[model samples]
Target: MRNKNSRNNREVMKRILGCIRPYWFLVLLSLLLAVITVVLTLYIPILTGQAVDLIVGKGDVNFTGLLAVIRNIAVAIAGTAVAQWFMNHINNKITYHIVQDLRTRTFHHLQVLPLSYIDAHPAGDLISRVITDIEQFSDGLLMGFTQLFTGVITIVGTILFMLSINLWITLVVVCLSPLSFFIAGFISKKTFTMFKKQSETRGELTGLTDEMLGNLKVVQAFGHQEKAQEEFEEINSRLAEYSLKATFFSSITNPATRFMYAAIYAGVTIAGCFTVIGGGLTIGQLTSFLSYTNQYTKPFNEITGVITELQNSLASAARVFQLLDEPALLKDVPGAPALENVQGKVSLNQVYFSYLPEVRLIEDFNLDVCPGQRIAIVGPTGCGKTTVINLLMRFYDVTGGSISVDGCDIREVTRESLRTNYGMVLQETWLKSGTIRENIAYGSPDASEEEIIQAAREAHAHSFIMRMPDGYDTVIGEDGGSLSQGQKQLLCIARVMLNLPPMLILDEATSSIDTMTEIRIQKAFAKMMKGRTSFIVAHRLSTIRESDVILVMKDGHIIEQGTHESLLEKGGFYAELYNSQFAPAG
Candidate 1:
C-alpha cells in the first residue's frame, strides 16, 4: 500500500511539473533570484564574523575594518531583500497562471464528458472538485514555490560555506541533519493518507452543503430538515475527524525536525569550542561556522513544514487529476458530415441501452416517424420516458443497434450539428444570470429585439415580462431571481420559440404554467408544429391528445400506440393512464 501511494504521489508530482513547464522562463528566473538571495544572505554571516575578528582586543579593535564589514553586511542584506521580493512575485505569477490553466482545461473537459457520467455523479461533488480542490492545490503549489526552492538552496549554500571553514564541524552538522530528515520523512508518510482522506471528506461536506442549500425549500416542504441536518452533521463530523488527524500528523513534523536540529546545533557549538581552544580554528572562524550551522538547520525546519503542506496539496491534486482523467466523449467521426437541411425523419431500430450494465432500462426499442408527424410518448415514472428523448438527442449512444436522423446515423454527424437542428424545452427550466432578452436569445444570439419580443409574446410571457422594472432588459439571477416557476418556464419556452429548429422535443415544456397560459402556449405550439417533426413527452394526457401517434410505454417497452381517441377505445395502459388523470374524485 505504501509503495502504491508513493507511486501515485510521484505521478501527481510529475503532472504538476508538466503544468509548470509552460512557464519555465518565470520559474527559471525565480530560481536564479533564489540563488542570488541565498548567496547574498550567506555573505552577511561572513561579514559579521569578519567584524568579530576586527574587534580583536576591545580598545585595540580595527574600527575602520569593522565599519567596512558593517557596510558590506548592509549591502548584502539589501540585495537579499530585493532578490527575495522578486522571487516571491514570480512564484505568485506562476502559481496563479497554472491554476488558471488547470481550471480552464478541467471545465472544458467537463463539457465533453458523457451525460451518463454526469447522471451517475453528484453535481456538488463535481463542482467541489473543479473549484474548491483546485484552490487548495494552488495554495500548496505557491508554498512549494516560495519556500521549498529557497530552503533547499539555503541548505546547500550553508553547507558549502561551512566546509570552507572547518571540515570536521561541517561533517558533524551533515551527519545530524539526516536525523531531522528521517523524522520528517516518517511523519510525512503518515500524513499523506490522512490528508487524502481529509480532502475527500471535505469534498463530501461541500457536496452535502450544496445539495441541502440548493433544495432547502423542498426539504422544508417535505419535513426532511432534521434528516438532512443529520446527514450533513455526519459528514461534517467525519471531515473534522480526518482533518484533526491529518493536521496532528503534519504538525508533528515541524517540531520534531526542530528538536533534532537543536541537538545538532548544540553538538556543533560544543565541537567548535574545543576546536577554538586547540587553535584548530580562529574565534572568528568558529563564530562564522556557528552562523552557518544555524543557517543549515533553519531550512530543515521550513522544508519539513513545506513537506507537510505538500502532502496535503498532492492529495487535493489527485482528486483534480481524477476528474481530468475521466474518459471524455469520443470526438466526432472523422470527415463526418454536418447535419444540414434536416427534414426530421427519425428512426430507431433494435436500440438497446441501460444506465447500469446489470439492470436493463431500455431494450430492443424501435420507432419510426415521418418528416412532419407529431409523436407523443407517455409512460409511468421510471419507465424510460426521458431515456428515449436522451437517445433521440444522442446524449447517450445505444449499446446495440442504431438511431438515425433523415437516414444519416446520428453517430456519423457532429453532435453540435445534430443538436443545433433541434429545439428542446425540458420540464426543468434553466436560466443564466442575465437579462431577459439575453435568456430569450440564448439559442439564437443573433436574434433581433423584435424577434425576441415576438417569441415571448407567442409563449404568453410578454405581459409579465413587460411589467418588470426593466421590461425586456431586466436582469435575473442564476435560477431566475424573484420569478415564479411558471415565469421561468415561460422564458425557457420563449428561448426555444426564438429559434424554432427543424425538429422539436418538448418534455413537459408547459408543465409549470397556469392552465390559461398553457392553453395559449398550446395554440402557439400548434402553429409552430404545423409542418415540423415534434416529439412531446408529458404526464398530462390531455395536453398530448392531438398527437398523431401516442406511444404508451411500460418498463422500457411500448405497450400501446395510436391516436388518443383510438387508445381510449382499446382501454389498455394508455386509456387507463389517461382516465386516471381525468377520473372523477372518489
Candidate 2:
C-alpha cells in the first residue's frame, strides 16, 4: 500500500509538471535570477569578514577602507533585492497561466463528458475540483518554486565558502544537518495522513452545501431548515476535528526542527573557539564560518515549512486527477456520417438498459414511429419516459440493441448532427442569462428579428415578452429566474419553435401554465405538429386525446397501446389511469 501511494504521488507530480511544460522559459528565467540573487547576497558575509580582519590586524579601525567596503556591500544588497523581486513577478505569471490552462482543460472535458457522468457527480464537488483545488495547487507551486530555487543555491554556495575557511567545523555542521531533516520527515508523515482526510471532508462539506442551497426552495417548503442545519453542524464538526489535527502537527514541525538546528549551532561555536584559541583558526574565519552554518541550515527549515503546504496541495491534485481520469466519455465513431435532410422516422429495437448493473430500469423496449406521426407516451414517474428521451438524444448510449433515425444507427452519426435534427422542450425549463430575443434565437443564431417574433407568437409568449422592461430585448436572469415558471417554459418553447426541426419532443412542456394559456399553447403546438414527427409525454389524458396513438408504460414496459377512445373502452391500465385523473370527488 505504501509503494502504491508513492507511485500515485509521482504520477500526480508528473501531470502537474506537464502543465508547466509550456511555461518552461519563464520558470528557467526565475531560476536564473535566483542564482544571481543568491550569489550576490553571499558576498555580504565575505566582505564583512574581510573588514573585520583589516581593522583587527592593524589594531586600529581603517575608517576609509571600512567605508568603501560598506558602500559596495550595500549596493550589492540592493541589486540582489531587485533581482529577487523580478523572480517573484515571473513566478506569479507562470503560476496563473498554469492555473488557467488547468481550468480550461477541466471545463472542456466537462462539456464532452456524457450526461451519465454529470448525473453521477455532484455539481459542487466538481466546482471545488476546478476552482478550489486548482488554486491550492497554484499556491503550493508558487512557494515551492520561490524558496526551493534560492534555498538550493544558498546551501551549495555556503558550504563551498565554509570549506575554504575551515573544513573541521564544516564537517561538524554536515553531520548535524540530517537531524533537522529526520525531524521534519517525522512530522510530515503524521501530518499528511490528517491533511488528506481534512481535504476529503472539506469537499464533502462543499457538495452538501451546494446541494442544499441549490434546492433551498424545496427545503424551505418542507420545513427542513432544522434538519439541514443539524446535518451541516455534524459535518462541520468533523471538518474541524481533522483540520485541528493537521494544523497542530504542521505547526510543531518548525519549532521542533529549529531546536535541533540551535543545538548544532552551539556545538559548532564551541568547537570553533577551541580551534581559535589553539592559533589554528583566525577570528575572521570563525565569524565567516558561523555565518555559513546559519546559511546552510536555513533551507532545511524553509523546506520543512513548505513540505506541510505541499501535503495539502498533493491531496488536492489527486482529487483533480481523479476527476480528469474518469472513463473517457462517449464520442462520435471515427468517420461517422453526418445526419442530414432528416425525415423523422425513429425506431428503438430490443433496447435494454439500467442505471446500475444489478437493477434494470429498461428491458426489451421496442418502438417504431412512421414519418410525421404524433405519438403520446403516458407513464408514471419512474417508468422510463425520460430515459427513453435520453437514449433517443444520445445523451446516453444504450447498453443493448440500437436506436436509429431513418435506418441510420444513431451511434454511427455525429452526435452534433443527430441532435440538430430534433428540437426538445422539457418540463424543467432552462434559459441562459441573456435577453429575451437571444433566448428565443438560441439554436438559430442567425434568425432575423421578424422570425424571432413569429416564433414567440407561435409559442404564445410574445405578449409577456413585450410587457418586459425592454420588450423583446429584455435581458433574462440566469435560468430565467427573474421570470415566472410559466414564462420560462414559454421561452423554452419559443426556442424550439425557432429551430423548427423535422422532429419535436414535448415532455410535460406546459404543466406549469394555467388552463387558458395551455389551451392556446396546445393550439399552437397542433399547428406546429402538422407535418413533423412528434413525441408527447404527458400525465394529463386531456392533452393526448388528439394523439394518433398513445403508449401506456409501467415497469419499463409498454403495458398498453391505442387511441384514447380505444384505451378507455378496453378498461385496462391506461383506462384506469385516464379515469383516475378525471374521477369525481366523493
lDDT of each: 0.92, 0.88
RMSD (CA, Å), each prediction:
1.0, 1.7
**Stretches of candidate 2 exceeding 4 Å from the true structure:** 57-59
Report lDDT (Cα) of residue 193, candidate 2.
73
The worst-scoring run of ten residues by lDDT in candidate 2 lies at 1-10
Model 2 TM-score, all chains together? 0.96
Instruction: Tell me the TM-score of model 1.
Output: 0.99
User: Tens digit of lDDT per residue, candidate 2, span 1-586?
Assistant: 5677668778988998898899999989998999899888888888878778768866688889899989989998999999999999998898888888888988888888778889988888888889888888888888888888888889888888888888888888988888888889888888877877887888888999999987899999999999999999998999999999999999998999889888988998999999999997888778878888888878878988889888778888888888888876767888999999999999999999888899989899999999899999998889998888888888888999999999999999999998898889999988999899988999999999999999999999999988888998888788896799999999999999887889989999889899999999999899989889999999887999999889999988889998999999999999889879999998
lDDT of model 2, residue 39: 85
lDDT of 2 at 344: 91
Clash pairs detected, candidate 2? none
Q: How many clashes in each structure?
A: 0, 0
Best candidate according to lDDT: 1
Candidate 2 overall Cα lDDT vs. reference? 0.88
- Among the numbered candidates, top TM-score falls to 1
